[model samples]
Target: MENKEIARVLWETADLMEIAGEDSFRIRSYRNSATSIEGYPERIIDILKDENRKVTEIPGIGKRLASVLQEIVDRGSCERRDELLKKFPPTALEFLKIQGLGPKGIALIFEHHQITTMDELEQLCKDEKLRLLPRMGAKLEEKVLRSIAQYKMRTGRFLLSFAHEAAEELKKYLAETGGVEEITAAGSLRRGKETVGDLDLLVTGPNATEVLERFVAYPRVHEILGRGANKASAKVGREGLQVDVRALPRESYGAAMQYFTGSKEHNVAVRTRAVKMGFKLSEYGLFRADNDTRVAGESEQEVYDALGLAWIPPELRENSGEIEAAGEGRLPELIELKHIRGDIHMHTTETDGRASLEEMAEAAKNLGYEYVAITDHSKAIAMANGLDETRAVAFARQVRELNRQDRGIRIFSGLECDILKDGALDLANDALAELDLVIGSVHSHMNLEPAEMTDRLLRALECPSLRVLGHPTGRLLMQREPFSFDFDRVVMEAVKRGVHFEINASPERLDLNGNLVRSAKQRGAKFTVSTDAHHPKHLHNMWYGVVTARRGWLGPADVLNTLPAERFRNAIRHN
Candidate 1:
């Protein structure tokens, strides 16, 4: 099993144990171990192969957990997880996918109504029968209905991050199978869409038969749907995510890749242009219409060169005028991961983060960062153990002392302060004035009317200490929608106040999405791409944000954090 698969099973085990009323401490141990395993940079199997290694060296893995991991790796399954599966009805686990329903809720429905399937649950909601159960009132029943609808809408799609994880693992596995020359993931994944329906892989090599055989035999393959001489399809893991693989000869690799990695609109536009140019473009190769003379097909660049244009980036091939830009040579040089100099929005053990200040600093320094900001939660978010005014002051002092130590990376004391519903700052001006930076955000009252939300944001931006707005929309992809507000007005106000917008890099909340970023950029508003990381490993999420920014057509100059530390400080000060 892959690390992600093993971690998923362990997480499900924890959820099942919670419903079964197992010991709380034991359940926490399982949850912690799963988190650590999922975030681990290297494969657990690689670690196990080292003679001097011990699984216990991992943060949350103890002797018992290590034994379980070994069992999963060696036998392709864990006995404990199998035992847990036997305790529930065949369809009971499906309830976990329904929002507004926890394991306890599922257990209650099963005990009282014998509801074992999604169809039964939906029927019960339609009949208003759910309200008969404990804690299920009219409001709760309505919420359950909405949740069911939302869950159904998102059933077949997977988050970009999740699909990327699976694709990377599969790519590595196939590349290691001797005979494969080149491999790449295509389709929506190549376009960097926020969500994808399925993964499409293209491979070119001499050992097509060997690659096909190896793919079907993969441990994570749940079912083989079809197989052909050079093409294969399968549903993988418990999520039933479909994967399709196509093998091609080296000569046709580039044309086939461009053909497959397409937005339908973009493909139509390209085909029209090819027709106008007296050439036939296809997966086979670009050819002259009258003589069938092959022109270009070996590389993607060559294919575009034959079309009298520069190569358009995959992220910009959305039929959004990118073809015109490429033809006119007006495409922006999009920001890259290497262009990022620091991350300004992150947390520490000071407020709900897994890593400490020093550990986060070291990790940023390791990434060749010139600076990092410790922007923990304010008191409004009590669950994160947010800091009060006095605590904020002391934290600032501590950061100053750490800077004095010259740790190779500059540490800035910052606060992710709450913007209250009444348009008041959570911290006093005196406290805010002491910090190197301030990030104001909405933590509650997300249901305000459009005008009210706009007014609230306007007030927050008026604060002199406020530098950036974190996750302006407060959206959690696949779980919540952005609140209603006048986005244009908000962007205009941000520009007037000189408060930069944030492109939060967290995979779950890539807020100020591509569309919004582009809109803001047209208005001459600057942005900061922040990881919003709570764990050290999450710092790597910067790549996702950079891709999102590129999709929005943003250049390096449009992002504030790309500046050197000294220049960045000056810009923030003047703002």
Candidate 2:
């Protein structure tokens, strides 16, 4: 098993243990081991198979955990997880996904009622029987109902990251099969949608029909849904993400790619344009309608040229003015990963971050960032050991000292200050003034009414130190909907106050989402694309933010940190 696969089992085991009322310390050990293995560079299986090496050498892996790891690598399962699964209904694990439901809540639901499925659970919530239970109340029932709706909406759909990883694996496998000449991701994966229902891969190769055999026998292939001469479909990964692979003839590769890599609306618009111009466009080729003679088929560029348009980028293939822009030669030069100059939103060991300030800076330097800001949490998040006024000021001094060193990267001291309930800053103005940048965020009271949330954000923007608003919508993808607020009003105030919106790069919380990002851009708001990194590995997630930026039609010029360190520093000051 891959390290990620092993870690997933360990995590599920921990969650199941929690539901089983296992000891707190033991459960924590499982969770910690999962985390350790997930980030460890080397393959745990390789280390385990080597007689001279011991997996226990890694932190957090004790003798018991080491044995558990061995069992997992050997048989892909452990005794404890099997035991837990046998005890709970099939939906026990599934119920944990509901927003307001916890393990204890699931355990209670199972004990009190013979609820077998989601429909029954929804019915239970509607019947108000859950409020009679311990800890859960009427509010929770309402929240669960909403969560179930959201969960239903997200069902069978995988996150873009999940599909991307799966695609990379398949692409690598197919490339290694020897005859594959080229592989291009099509569908929403190519377009970089935040969520995907399935993946479509278009391949051109000498062995057109033979690749399906190798794909069907892939180690991750859980089930072969179908097989054909030109295409093969399979359920891949533990998540059962559907993947379709097509082997294409090189002559029509571009046409197939353009037709298959479509948002249906975009495809319809382009096809209609072709029809009006007396051409028939299809996956086979673009041809003259009268003669049925091919006009263009070899390249996406040629296909677009045939349509009297410049080549449109894959990211802009959503019929949202991209077609018109392409015809007029006005499509944006969208932001790329190379255009990023810095990652300015990050945490350090001073608060919830796993890495020290020095370690994070070294990581950023290795990533070729011109500058990085150590934006640890402010006092509002006590659980994260967030900085108080004294600590915040001391941290600023420490960062200033670090800036004096020849570290090969510019370091900025900053805080992710909380926008508290009453619209006040978490730290005092004196403390905030000492920092280089402040990202005001809503960490609590997300349930506030729209007008109230707007007022709170508007007030937070009044702070001179607050250069950016962090994760403006407060949404956890597939987990929580964005908190309701008058986004237009808040963003207008932020723009007036010289504050930028943050496109937080964390996969789970890619807020502001692309829709909001585009909306804010229309209202004259600029953005800073940040990973909101809490660990060194998280720094690599900047590409995901770049994807969100490109999807929102952001050009490099629209992003503030694309500037060099000195210019960027001056721009965020709001002076």
Candidate 3:
């Protein structure tokens, strides 16, 4: 199992245990281990397979938990999860996906109503029945119904990172088999969509027949949905993501990639262009209208060249003006991962982060970054033991001391200060001024009116100490919808105030998504593509942020962190 899948197994078990009213310490162990495993840079399965390695060496992983991990890897489940599923309806886990309903809430509902499916839960809400439950109210019921609708819309979708892992694993498995010369990912995975519905792989080699056969027998293949000499389909991984693989002739490789890696609209546009040019375009090849002779099919560049356009990057293949931009030779040179010199929004152990300040700085330096910012939580987050004024100023001086030691990375002392509901900054002006930067964030009151939310952000921007607005939308991908707001107005104000926006790179919270990024960029707003990382391994997620920036048509010049150490320092709002 991949590290993420293993982490999910333990996390779900922990949640089930919590609902069962199990020991809090044991539950905390499971939760901590899950967090550790999820942020681990290497696959847990690989460590288990290595004779020299011990799974117990992983922090928080005791011998018992280690054995549980082994059992999970062996058959995709452990005894604990199996037992818990029997005690509670398995669908109770599904109920946890609702925004307003957590494990405790689910337990309350189950104890009172014994609801099994989403429909019953929705009915309970609609009937005004849940109001009688402890701590539940009419407002909670309304939120539950809305959350259920959102959950249903996102039921089959998996995060891009999850699907990417599955696709990469399949590629590696197939590469070992003969006749698999090249394996390339296509579809939404290639396009860097935040969520993927399914996976698509294109393969080419001398003997495709053997590859197709090997594909069906791969270890992760839970079920072979279909099979053919040149193509195959299967459900793979614990996520049961449907994967389709096509083995194509080398001559048609590029044509097939173009046809398969498409947004339906983009493909339609490309095909229409081909038709206008007196050529036929399909997965096979580009052919003359007057004859069946193949024209350009060897490479994507050739295909685009034949169509009298430049090759569009996969991230820009949403048919949202990329085709026109390509034809006009006006496509932006998108930002790349290598262009980033620093990651400015991250946490350390002093707040809610797992890693300490020195450790986070070391990880950043190892990644070849010249600078990093430790933007730990400010005083508003009581649960995180967030920093008050004295602690915040002390931490800034501590970072200053570390920088004096020339630890090889310039550590900027900062705080992710909350923006209070009444449009005020969480930390005092003098406290914020003691730091290099302050990233204003909203951690509560996400359901404010659109005008209120807009005004809230607009008010936050007036704080001169604020540099970057952290995860501006406050979205958690499929789990939560963005708070309603006038985005353009808020972004315009940020630009006006010389405060930049942040492209938060956490896979679960790639907030300020492509559309919003592009919208803000067009309004003359600058940005920082940060991981908002709480762990060292999470820093690697910068690539996902770069992909998001590319989708927004942002170039290196548009992102402040892409600047060099001193330049980036001087570029942001000076304290």
Candidate 4:
């Protein structure tokens, strides 16, 4: 078949399996392969005809799948895949992307009522056809229609951080209207949640009428949701971009900002703490006056100080022990990106990476990293151009010679060894021991039951040569949830075994998310935040990982890789 035909088939198959609720990893392989084919610079068939052709060397195509791909290319179809694709049409795949509509849910809606396309699906949902189906009701139908309308209007939502940019744009417009004095973002956007539901803006202005008029007339204002004297809300663009503006007096600005910026739980706790301390907390400001005399205002810290506590970071202000820690003066001095002395996980051309060993080392030097661990893929993950012993030994020699050069950065020979189903490392211990750091990871076998999966992971952690576990949860955000595992117990076992956990910095896979990173830190497990970068551009993913670490309240001393070069080497050697 033609390349486009093959790509279409693969995409449809993956979508069908998604509707079937098949194992995510297995489903992901097909999706990744489809993406690879679609984006590949060379034609798939042309690449297949070369003598040196090895499809398995592609980043997303593993050995077994590569062979299957060859068969599909030769025969113009995969009989098995075609049979599966018949269950779900390509047109219906669009419905699955809507919020609250998983593949199984879509399949159920389609199966019961023969819903086949987005328009049909939307009408059925709006007309309450889904309510007549099992396990669905009027409320569910309304939610489905709303979600469908949203998806139809928007490509996707913005990341939580990006919401600040949108809020700032609207704020600046309102500020220039000659009535507003101060503006800020509130709600989950301010608290650093990964994804925001909508953007919320609060402004203190002199004239409510003028400010409201200006907001409604703004160039980007697509639709006005509501407008009142004290508050006005609107949606911008097809993405449902929301901006909320509130008018407040100068006296109440600080308190209002703090209250609105808080996670509701955090606000409740703070207010309770204030009441117990014989003060009242509100949007106007913290006050001790029973007869309306001012006590604290002008600054958020002063308000917190009046209640007797240090300021807590927005990321940790989830009412998750942050207030108590502040009261006890035990808030961790969170680590900064500058403190990272070395990177223990990275990729080079020995695998599917875009850079060679020398190039990666020089890049590390430029970044001021004291050391770079060149952990290319191990043999078990052939799709990543996983190295065999012969090639690995040669690469080791190359890295060693490079290390001896006059470069300022130290280079550590390393491999991201895949953990097999039988709880064995992809490379032998002796082979791994020759390296400075060995990162054990699960690249497959996501279908294992929770108990079995936990055991498999624990066994991999027990490897003496294994120094770090990479992306232990195996989740792909928004696209897929992590595989089933008792992460608490996993953290406990990792701590007990003296193995390190990795915060994979690949933007697509900031694996050990901030909350879990904090949880693991509290359990005595050391961490190394590395980019797991496959290309030069990906090295910056470390910044996201750092923010995640800070969210977990980790300090410089808590990260193993932030040690001085000598100490970092010693830690590796000792482990």
Q: Model 1 scores what on Cα lDDT?
A: 0.87
TM-score of each model, in listed order: 0.93, 0.97, 0.94, 0.70
455-527 per-residue lDDT for model 1 (tens digits): 9998998888999998999988877778889989989999988899999988888898888999899987889
Provide the global lDDT of candidate 4 against the true structure: 0.78
Q: Sort by TM-score, best first: what order?
A: 2, 3, 1, 4
Please write out the lDDT profile of model 4 over residues 414-451, one tens digit for every residue: 88889999788888776777777888988898868999
Total colliding residue pairs, candidate 1? 0
Please identify model 4 stretches exceeding 4 Å from their true place: 1-158, 161-184, 202-221, 227-232, 236-238, 245-251, 348-350, 354-367
* Tens-place lDDT digits, model 2, residues 552-572: 999999998899999988887
Model 1 lDDT at residue 115: 62
Error of 3 at 225 (Å): 1.7
Off by over 4 Å in 2: 127-139
Worst 10 residues of 4 by lDDT: 153-162
Residue range 1-575, candidate 3, lDDT tens digits: 67888899999999899888899999999999998898887889999999999989998999999999999999989999999988788788888878788878998998898778999999999999999999999999999999899888998899888888788888888888876677999998899999999999999989766788888988778999999888899998666899999999989999999989998889999999999999999999899999889998878888999999999999999999999999999999988999999999899889999899889989999999989999999888989999999999999888888888888889999999999997799889888988987899999999899999999999999998999899999998888788899998998888889988999989998888899999899999999999999988889999889889888999999999999988877876474
Clashes of each: 0, 0, 0, 0
Lowest summed lDDT over 10 consecutive residues: which window, candidate 2?
566-575
Error of 3 at 96 (Å): 1.3
Best by TM-score: 2
Candidate 2 lDDT at 13 equals 91
